[model samples]
Target: MSLPDDTRYLKGGPVAKRIMAEVARDAAKATAEGFPPKLVSITVGDVEAVGVYVRNQRAKAEQAGIGFEERNFPADLTAAELEAAIHGMNADPRVTGIIIQRPVPRHIPIKAIQAAVHPLKDVEGMHPASIGNIVYNELDLAPCTAAASVELLKETGLDLKGLEVVVVGHSEIVGKPIAFLLMSEGATVTVCHHMTRSVAAHARRADALFVAVGKPRLIKADMVKPGAAVIDIGINTETGPDGKERIVGDVDTDSVKEVASWITPVPGGVGPITVSILLRNTMVALARQRALYQATYGTAE
Candidate 1:
């Protein structure tokens, strides 16, 4: 018989706080060097979801001793204007990271907009160059959300050489990078998406499972291997039996907790860790850009 204490809840609060402290130290060092790091977020419209995300990042930036700036543009702006603005940020050394929020006007091409961001300042890791770097196993600049899942798995101390890992989502931002990053660590990783037939069959045999598709409670108790670690990266809001609103993950926490060795909670799991990694990425941009400057010139300044 399984007990309530059989499973461990993996929370991101502690991990994120530790990372924030380290990022603050790095931010202080960069400030002392007269090149304080800053993150510039580009927002095209006033999407409610994007606003919430921007607020969370702003608070974290202040806590980490990094400066955060937001640039808002009208939806009617021309493509040429957007490209020129991105180019200016790329050339400006004060700008440490550039994040373009989504849900832009349909006239503007999202891919083209993301492409305009310089690879050095692409803190979100959506740039093609940043994504390509992971193929060669160069992980210093990997995607933040994907890196968070990897960081959590590292806590388990599972031998990576032959571990069986199943990822339930194949989205570009979170899933693909995770599969590649896991493979780089020698784990045999299988990626499944909406088109993957019998996804649960693949998930039930893994030493570790990562779920990031937007569906709520898609992975039930039967789909998880006993003692397998579960990482839930999905964030969904819905009405519960009580007729009140609730937030949940892709994994059914109530049922799956009884069987899994470790599981991440919906509201407190990957979100915080991912944000901290974003700040950490911002902190490193100074050193990375300084290296580029040195290679181009004789010094960082």
Candidate 2:
């Protein structure tokens, strides 16, 4: 869909590139300092959908000069056994971060696996402590998608201080964290969930709006404030009239772009930036680990 000249489409490539460049520089410095960052991915069972995500992560990690390792566990492995492996990685000084791939076999609880990863090594930011850090304004180790969405907002060059922001979605990973991060930046954030009385009413009053609900086209042009910056963090697959599958975001981009001053396009927006943010978190984890090592052994190693 072609965008109107009045609206600016926020592409993730340039932002991701800028961030990855910084990460690569930091990674190279860390490598020279003998504290290179390494990320370990834990995948349970065979999930075809997850394989694509893992490949992308590995490619981006390599670009950032970070080590990537994939550890595939048996589908039938008990949760306790999986947690033991995660604990082992937590205790391994070589492993800088841990990523738990989604859609593990129904038998194992995803949250349980996330909890097993130590907070210092939870680069994915799924751990409870990592999320809690955002509440206290410790923004370095936030969830990737949430951090990327905020990064895109900052790219608009609007002053976040005292800006009116509406977030349509309250999931722990995306919406809630985004609210906290923005508030930490001094933006007044209103979070709307399924039970909100009038999401559109709140959305239309914001200077900056973010939508992360799974429903496609949930935010129309009418729902957005004119000249507002819209960040669509939701990824949904929809089949067109011709039966071809396509990825889309929560906002109706074609229509919303006409109203919004800036908007992010699905498949080219937050996805790429999210991967870069993951690598950034890896460096943060590595820095924290290096501090601990220095305190304990009087050396970065």
Candidate 3:
């Protein structure tokens, strides 16, 4: 049976642009007072997709009036080099926030690199300290994409409290943190992984479902509960009939849209919001630092 065409799409790009513009205004005020906000992104290797993502992030940071720095390492660089890069950014006073793009070189140890970044500057929220803050429900900056997921839901005017939310995938960046954020918002969250027994069963019972397994078309129509809100965070590329590749998300959008009450389309949805959240985090960091500075000194002229 064909699913119902009752889906509500959440467009994130325009919302992100608007939010960043606000941040830019605030940043301008701070800079006029002699304190400038800055963000640095560290990337290893030259993976095409990762490069594109980082470039977009840098562009957004610049447009937001946040200082942007790019630190590039060779593909064959050792883990120690990556750690050094993080340490350098951590020590740089000009850098208010730092982000390390994922899918680092296979030979590099991500855990070690993540540990080297100072918790304050780890704007991507991948550090253990940041995760601990999340676990303890502290007022620390959350992982950007995870926070963006919550923002997307709220922007849709949906109430999250007491909802049955199911998240597929167990990645530290998107899956686990998002579950924590949803739970913190008072939603009953169930986290499923690649090996979960009957993952579809769990998904079918959700009031809201977020999928980020990085597999194209992983979440099918039947697996989604009727009227459930589905957020697809995966971006996978596959070769088309003409030998070119196209980007696709976890949900079978065409079919799932019929069943879901609300959904996020891949290209226009989560990607933009995630970048927006990163800028927001940078703004937050800058504001806090500015406040501390003002308290130490006197108000600017």
Best by lDDT: 2
* Candidate 3 C-alpha lDDT tens digits along 1-301: 3345566787788778778888889889978977788887778888576888878888888888888878777898888877877787787778898877778888988788877878777777778988888888763478887887777777767788899999999899789998888888888999999789999999999988999999999999999998888888889998878999898899999889888888888778888887878887777777766666578796777
Best by TM-score: 2
Enumerate residue pairs that collide in model 3. none
Q: Candidate 2 residues 53-130, lDDT tens each?
A: 999999999988999999999999999999999999999999999999998999998898899999999999989999
Worst 10 residues of 3 by lDDT: 1-10
Poorest lDDT segment (10 consecutive residues) of candidate 1: 1-10
- Reference-based lDDT, residue 42, model 2: 89
RMSD of each: 2.2, 1.7, 3.3
lDDT of 3: 0.83
lDDT of each: 0.89, 0.94, 0.83
lDDT of 1 by residue, 83-164 (tens): 9999999999889999888888888899999989998998988899999988888887788999998888887777888899
Q: Rank the candidates by lDDT, best first.
A: 2, 1, 3
Give lDDT: candidate 1, residue 215: 93
